[model samples]
Target: MQRRRFKETSSLEERLDQEAMRLREHKLLPPGWLREQAFRKARQMNIAAHINEWLASPGLRAPI
Candidate 1:
């Protein structure tokens, strides 16, 4: 096996810019309603987790 190393360390801003460029090179991302749906799904999952946690604690039970 061989080891590899970066020519030099990169700053946080430079790393983020590089990531954005790489993503753009990959065709295009979902847009409009599709993008909205993706975000909504993520939010729904987060809310579900919070609700489940609350339900698990009798003192924090949500009103039926």
Candidate 2:
């Protein structure tokens, strides 16, 4: 087996922003499983992004 990797042309913020917008579009649907699926993914993505941001915040370090 072989592993493949490629460069990401967009920044993390840019990618997340685009994905968020895409998920929001799902809300236009009346009601269905697809909308729920998108909602869950969006929620997970939002939470993960926030958690990562908090973990990387400078306040997490011991005070000097």
Candidate 3:
């Protein structure tokens, strides 16, 4: 069996621009919007995880 190797010839900026253009063409989000959305999702996830951990810890589980 033979394996094929692929090379990335484009610069990082070029790749990013191409991706942003593709997103725009598809009526999806541009890079900034996508970044903001991802950040918001990550923040929400972190908050949820923290709350879960707080609830699970015996010291922090005291009733209000």
Candidate 4:
């Protein structure tokens, strides 16, 4: 088996800036506060989905 080496990646801020520029170019960028709110909402939804999946999996059981 060959081991894969990971390369260094850009920082989170850099990635976010790049995304923002893309959005701006496409005229889809939202206001700063709205963008922040949307990010928070997206994170919450992702966490909720993960928790729901864990609850539904067969390996775990609920206590009576």
Better of 2 and 4 by lDDT: 2
Backbone clash total, candidate 1? 0
Q: RMSD for each model, in Å, please?
A: 12.6, 2.8, 13.5, 10.1
lDDT of 1 by residue, 11-41 (tens): 4445545554454443344566655655555
lDDT (0 to 1) per candidate: 0.56, 0.81, 0.59, 0.59
Superior candidate under TM-score, 1 versus 2: 2
lDDT of 3: 0.59
1 or 4, which is superior by TM-score?
Answer: 4
Please report how far candidate 2 places residue 64 from its true position, in Å.
9.9
After superposing candidate 4, which stretches have Cα over 4 Å from the reference? 1-27, 62-64
Best by TM-score: 2
RMSD of candidate 3 to true structure, Å: 13.5
**TM-score per model over all chains:** 0.44, 0.67, 0.43, 0.48
Q: How many clashes show up per model?
A: 0, 0, 0, 0
Pairs clashing within candidate 2: none
Report the lDDT tens digits of candidate 2 across residue range 1-64.
9889899998665677678778978999879999999988887777777877788789898887
Stretches of candidate 1 exceeding 4 Å from the true structure: 1-30, 58-64
**Which residue pairs in candidate 3 collide?**
none
Could you give candidate 3's per-residue lDDT for residues 5-64 as a string of tens digits? 989898444555555444345334556776676556555555665666667779976678
* Candidate 3, backbone clash total: 0
